[model samples]
Target: MTLAELTAAQRHRVIAGTFTDRVRATKSWDAAAPVAGWTARDVVRHLVEWFPGFLAGGAGIELPRGPGVDEDPVAAWQTHADAVQAVLDDPATPGRTFANPHIGELPLDQAVDRFYTTDVFMHTWDLARATGQDDRLDADYAELLVTGMEPMEELMRSSGQYGPRVPVPAGADAQTRLLGFIGRDPSWCPS
Candidate 1:
């Protein structure tokens, strides 16, 4: 499938995942997420705060700022998600250039796929795990991400976007391997 098609599919999954997480977050926003020190509310907040910049930088479109998660987590996420979806849906956005610090100038669709799309997919797991929802990542998708990211692992780690690698068993599943590669422990849980 084309990058836009793939990203659209990923976006759908992210929206569904966020919906599920939001319901769980209502139960307990203070619940610890799989990510160190971040609560379930923080999981949604992170997306709210970061996605706009990524979409703006890649699509070259200015988006109006919306409510912070502290103000209204669900509305904040929905607003950002809708804005990002609008940008992704725009026919004129694909061929535009985005100057990324890590990858230099790249086509808008390519940048979104590499940077933002994958982030949504990965963080879906964090939100799910944080809120006692199903956190099992799709193994096929994990493998695809691993293949795309392995070559740039050093650069990504050095950029401080990812933490130190967590070792997994040799026979671990694709999701476990992918999590380890991204410096997340597959076995991590809130104590």
Candidate 2:
């Protein structure tokens, strides 16, 4: 099913599953990633470290702690993704509200789906590229995201979440346009 056609839980499962596959496939946690100074391990670390506070602060939902990324990137990511899935799977979570100073209030599921799950999806490419694996994103979903974000480019850049858009060829594929819009060089590789 298309990303827009999936429920929030299903969306997270699909996107996070791709990221988990990349995490498991990684052979070098310390390898430099496409994002300037970040390593493969750092990609997982960013997902693991950032979301818990946002979840807790907004929804009062605390994710269980897992092994450090330095110790085991696979286990660390698995734990974090599982915890997020559990929250999504919880029956009560659908009705819950998530509110924080920054984004105000949104359904807990939408908040997670919009912010955390999508982050995992994008970073899957980072982890994959860092370790020389398949780095292609789902083209339809990439198109969907780029289409949705195009109107918000100025705000997205101002938020410092996205960098200045990089130029890509006019006939570039959806994923290439997405990477360029997000300030990622579509052809990046570890040195």
Candidate 3:
């Protein structure tokens, strides 16, 4: 379904929650891939860092000052999660705006779903390798990955942002293929 087709509740319940399930598993061998100097705990902290900004004023929040409270690193994570859940619960907040990278224009609801779709989908492996949980991927999500990203593979790879492609095993599942293409070492971690 196109992004406009989904509701805020669905975005929060299905999409965002799924991302939480996925990202909560990520761990880095060096303990900092998800965020500088942070492990899996730190990665969640990172996503939580930006959670509140997704709803902007939709959460009935004053704009948080600065990049948030960095000293209390885990607090930023907790606050962001609570704020994101609040946006999902409030029907009036769908049209809100969230800040993000290269996402262009979109309302709060769409952005929230997109955040779940893009970040969680890819990071499923980032966490897998970072923490060594490759066998634990959600199979259902892996199947839909092609619909979400394959057609634009060449374009994304050519942009120098996604980087040179990695070859996929012949006839592998879509998730493995997509992860390999996006500069992740499907067979090795932290390459």
Candidate 4:
């Protein structure tokens, strides 16, 4: 699939996962997620806080920040997701050019796919783990990400976007290996 198509699919997964995690978070918003100190609410909060800047930078459109998760987690996520979806839905977005610190200037859609979409997908796992939901990521998507990111590992790590790679079992599943590549231990659980 093209990167745009992949991004769209990934976004759908993110939306579904976010909504699912939102429901789950009502029970334990303060529980620690797999990403160390971040809680279930913080997982959504991080996305709500960061996605608009990414959309604005890629689409060259002003997007005001919305309520934070502390104010209202569900509302915060819904608002942010809707704004991002609108940008992704726009016909002009694909053709627009945008500059990214990591990849420099590229088509807006490509930048969104590379940076934002992948983040949402990966963080879906964090939200799920935090909320005690099914956190087994799609193996195919995980494999694709692992392959695509291996070459850029140094750059990504250098930028502090990822932590030191964790060791995975030799026969670990693709999702396990992928999580390990991005510095998350697949077996992690909240204490």
| Candidate 3 Cα outliers beyond 4 Å, as residue runs | 1-8, 14-42, 45-75, 95-105, 154-161
lDDT of 2 by residue, 64-107 (tens): 99999899889988999999999999988889999988789999
* Candidate ordering by TM-score (highest first): 2, 4, 1, 3
Q: Which candidate is the best by lDDT?
A: 2
lDDT of 4 at 31: 84
| Of candidates 3 and 2, the better by lDDT | 2
lDDT of 2 at 98: 95
- Give one clash count per candidate, in the order shown: 0, 0, 4, 0
- Per-model RMSD to reference: 2.8, 0.9, 5.4, 2.6
The order of the candidates by lDDT, greatest first, is 2, 4, 1, 3
Model with the higher lDDT, candidate 1 or 4: 4
Per-residue CA lDDT of model 3 for 61-157, tens digit only, reads 5434333434443344345555556655777656666554555666666766655445544654555456656434444555555556668787666
Residues 53-131 of candidate 4: C-alpha lDDT, one tens digit per residue: 7667655677655777897788777776666677667788877888767567887766766676678778878877777
Global lDDT of each candidate: 0.73, 0.90, 0.54, 0.74
- Lowest lDDT block of 10, candidate 4: 1-10
TM-score of each: 0.86, 0.97, 0.62, 0.87
Candidate 2 lDDT (Cα, whole model)? 0.90
